[model samples]
Target: MTSRDAKTYEEAVEIVLRTLVKAERIKPTQYARRLVMKEMNPSREARSVSAGLLYSVLQKRGLLDEVIEDVLEITDDVTELDTWVRNAARIAVNEVVFEDGDPDEVADVLHGLVRRLANPGAAAIVKAFTLDLKDYEPPEPEDELDRLKWEYYHPRWLIERWMEMFGDPDEVVALLEANNRRPPLTIRVNTLKVDPEELAERLQRKYRVTVEPGRFLDEILKIPEGLPIGEMPEWEEGLFVIQDEAAALASAVLNPKPGEVVVDLCAAPGGKTTHMAQLMGGEGKIVAIDVDEVRMERLREIAERMGVLDCIETHLMDGREAPEKLGREFADAVLVDPPCSADGTIPKNPERRWRITPDELERLPKFQYELLKAGAEMVKPGGRLLYSTCSMFPEEDEEVVRRFLDEHPEFELLEVKVGDQGFDMPEACRLFPHRHETCGFFIALMGRTG
Candidate 1:
């Protein structure tokens, strides 16, 4: 808990290693980044460094273990090392294997740093490992899942499910690697003030930043490393809202018109809700409902921040049960971005893979279908209901749509042109990492016929 400047790369690595160990135990995945952010109090440079190191080490664990084995010469039982020591070895190995650093040089650096930061036994282990650094080779996979395990840096079970869905091994590897890399920061330019092209030009001139106009969402600007958009001049003036390209596409697909009453069933953090308000031209009512009180408050705050206050109304109620509270056929349109496995968002939440299970997958579609049915009932006759999820799994995407359509004969699927996002599936449209540069997602637009 003592604060000291990390003077060497080795000391920095030790700090990251210690933080990673503690994060793994305390928060696991979703909360891990927040924990690291809290502990490191990292400058931007340090954030990039620690994140890059953690991912590289995790991705190339096999090669890392070899480096550790070679360095520590005494291979009695490294598995018995305390979590901190194990993590340090992982960090050292990652540096040697992935960074292409000299194994001997890295070993020496790690040994000295461990001696200072860790106890004598830990220092001895690092010293012994360093002395034998040249005797190891990268481990080879013994099976398909093992091969995928190293290739994707994911668990074998998750890869197995992906293989089943994708049916192509090479494509699965590509998908997994894409998920591991840092996703681009995409923001939707608030067209109410400035067009996307003009915003992009201004950003480049002011911050030495570059933004590319997205294909699907005309307002989406792909910003490459600058000041956080929240602090930018454009943001302060309500000229833009930070949103992902895939998420921006959702509002475009919904295509709400002015004077329409739209309900965002699971709106929270207000990304899609605000976008829906923009689509409605900020003229009509948008009842943004979320079950969590905190998220509902956040939705209201974001709406106020983005200057979409005229149209948005916040409500705290579960979408599945809220139709009874609001009455049936109350809105002209309903946008349901339901909770799912979030498999498509692995690039942003790598720890989600560890948290998911077969049972959860089985149960999620049923929950989603119920929400879709409930949300659909809230749509007036001839109104549109858009169901979406940031999940690529068919059960949560196509199957859910198909079942809802089967049960509710009053609604029919509407063909939506997502502007080169991906192929339109039978009951829905899906975006994949291999095809779309955005997060893997699925959307189905349905119109109430009754």
Candidate 2:
């Protein structure tokens, strides 16, 4: 986190590539953003560009890594090399293939990047692959999913699963590629603080923020490129919060009423919880719970910033404890946006592409089931429970909701409607990245019919 850590673009890439390797070693519960912050205290100006590189490189690391291994296989063994060396090779290969620059200059810069940051022994290995990386190509796999996994930079198991569900390899490929693209930065206007139209007018006419009404909701705004969102005066005044459109829809579906009791079981950094506060006109009680105390504190901060502190109560307890601690049938409405494999929003946070394994992520569905069931238990008869995940995997989405319905016959999937664009299930819907133009997400609204 010193001035020497990330003073230039190549240096920044080096630091991130090194951290990327380290991030893979850490637990899935940890985030790479924190690792970057700790490793390099990049100044605001530096971070704008470097953070983009760090994320872009990491998000594409899966494909870049495949290419790197291919190059390593040509001359040496990847496993025999130091972890940092492999990461460096991936970054250099990513630059060679994807970066729009003078190819030779890019290669020269990478050589210098490795020489500066790598150990003497590792530098030789990285230098040996400099030009050879440009010509490296992956060996073809006969298996359809294996081919898609190599081409699209996704886990093979996930590709196979999606292919089986869709019955079309081409369709699954589109979804996988969509996750690799950089999604538009979107935000929801804080209606409690400012009028959406007026806020848009001010942002557009004055601050030059080009915002359009979102596809699903008028309150949400799609902020275009070329503007720093955090620097906007509206953001400082808490007139809006950066959130994905799918998550905004989930909160919109919950639709808490004024003075009603609501619980956001997996709420952290308070996106939906605060949005619920806005929907309730800052009049309802919302208990926001998350296991991470730091994020829970940020949730409180966001609530206060959005001028909705009076409505929300933050709790630093495990989401599993919400039903027991808050008492069963306590809330009029509940939202359990539980943690999943994060398949839906990878375009925005691309590091997820390489940071998780299929086996490592298998536990997501079981925990998602537990949280949804807990949220269901917390809803009173006639009240609603909305179970959502930023993932499109059937096991983590519809199947969990389906099982919950079977086990708790008292609850039935509520008829949640969207335009014909959404894949309508009997009681749930899956918003796909390719089809919906939103992060891959699933939501099932259930009512305690008993």
Candidate 3:
């Protein structure tokens, strides 16, 4: 709780900014938001003010770098300082450039932050802290790629990949720009607990929750704005699960029926696993295998909360061994929701871009391939093996599927009925961030021909 006195906005800003650095930057705003809720004086107004500043800086980080170039001092080899200094500077500059505060006061606060957190030299560098707001200007990049790179807030290599995928210059820029927007609040109803329409009515009547039926799936709903879902009584009662429309579609495409044995190979934090259980009307068994025990706990919790605990069993081990452990060709369906570069989720998980390197992206395909192959091995003859990733890359999606198809002659691409509710994708379909207003996702539903 905040002290009896309302915390100053500056104090709140510092607390949030510092926590962003402490928690690490992949999802800086989310990390910092949690920290403020837990540690900062519980002042709703103050927290919002701080959080507002924090999110702006994170979302427009590239633009901020371009606009506030004069503020940072870099050597020949390094154009950026370490994370602590850079983060504090970003917070400082965000307040100075964007916030409605006195420039000098903002600079003073920032200088103090740097001096305390970094070193004297760092604070001294920006000590003057004077700005002619009108006179300040962003530097122009020499080439087209350089210009788009900083402007869209994506790395040059990633942008190049998009350019290749999109082909058109304008379309590529539009795609990256769309990723910066806040993602929609899409949720899937736990049909095992309550029908979607019934749940929507209950929510509307009781809490006046604004619930719109999903564009495609009757079991899904779009909640325009929501309080923390976990806090909702209906959520505790397991009425719905918060899932992206694209991810929910993956489970739907798998379409597991009641009494069938299903397997989710990469099932930690199992949104799709529980969704499959719901699709089964809580009658079938699902072997949910994941390497991370801690994450699987959440999966278990979701299953238990959704009243489908009897249908799902979670195992703490490598999913690759499912064929051995679960028996060969034992599953009527297998879902491989492997961890890829996760580039498609940049809108929802903004910090992903900052954390991923070109080298790192190159290494994901082999791991994804292994997971997909494992899912295929466990699929019964004519059973579906649904391979999905929150990644838009060909290497992780199309290329991997192509390679798998070539090696396993018996398994062929299965038409997936997804997109705008119930359209068939000829082979595999991509859910583009810009086109679909969902995370960038690629799903390939392959089947054993027998």
Candidate number achieving the greatest lDDT relative to the actual structure:
2
Q: Which 10-residue span in candidate 3 carries the lowest summed lDDT?
A: 70-79
Q: Give the TM-score of candidate 3.
A: 0.83
**Candidate 3 lDDT by residue in tens digits, 1-450:** 234322466576677667667666433356356655665454556554665566567665655555546544433322365665566666656666655546666666666767787777776554453343324445678798888876767777788888887788888877888887766568888876677888888877876668888765788887665434534788888888778888888988888999999999999788999889988988879999999877798789888999988888878888777777777888899999998888888887765766567775679888888888888888889898889888877777888888888899999887765652111335787788888778888888888987
lDDT minimum window of 10 residues, candidate 1 = 1-10
Q: How big is the positional error of residue 349 in model 1, measured in Å on the Cα after superposition?
A: 3.1
Alpha carbon lDDT of each predicted model? 0.74, 0.75, 0.74
lDDT of 1 by residue, 157-265 (tens): 8889888877988888889878777666678877766777888898889878666777576788776563444346677777877677777777788888999899999
Candidate 2 C-alpha lDDT tens digits along 294-314:
778878888888999988887
User: Once superposed on the true structure, which residue ranges of model 1 sit more than 4 Å away at CA?
Assistant: 1-44, 54-93, 96-139, 226-238, 419-424
TM-score of each: 0.79, 0.83, 0.83
Candidate 1 lDDT at 109 equals 63
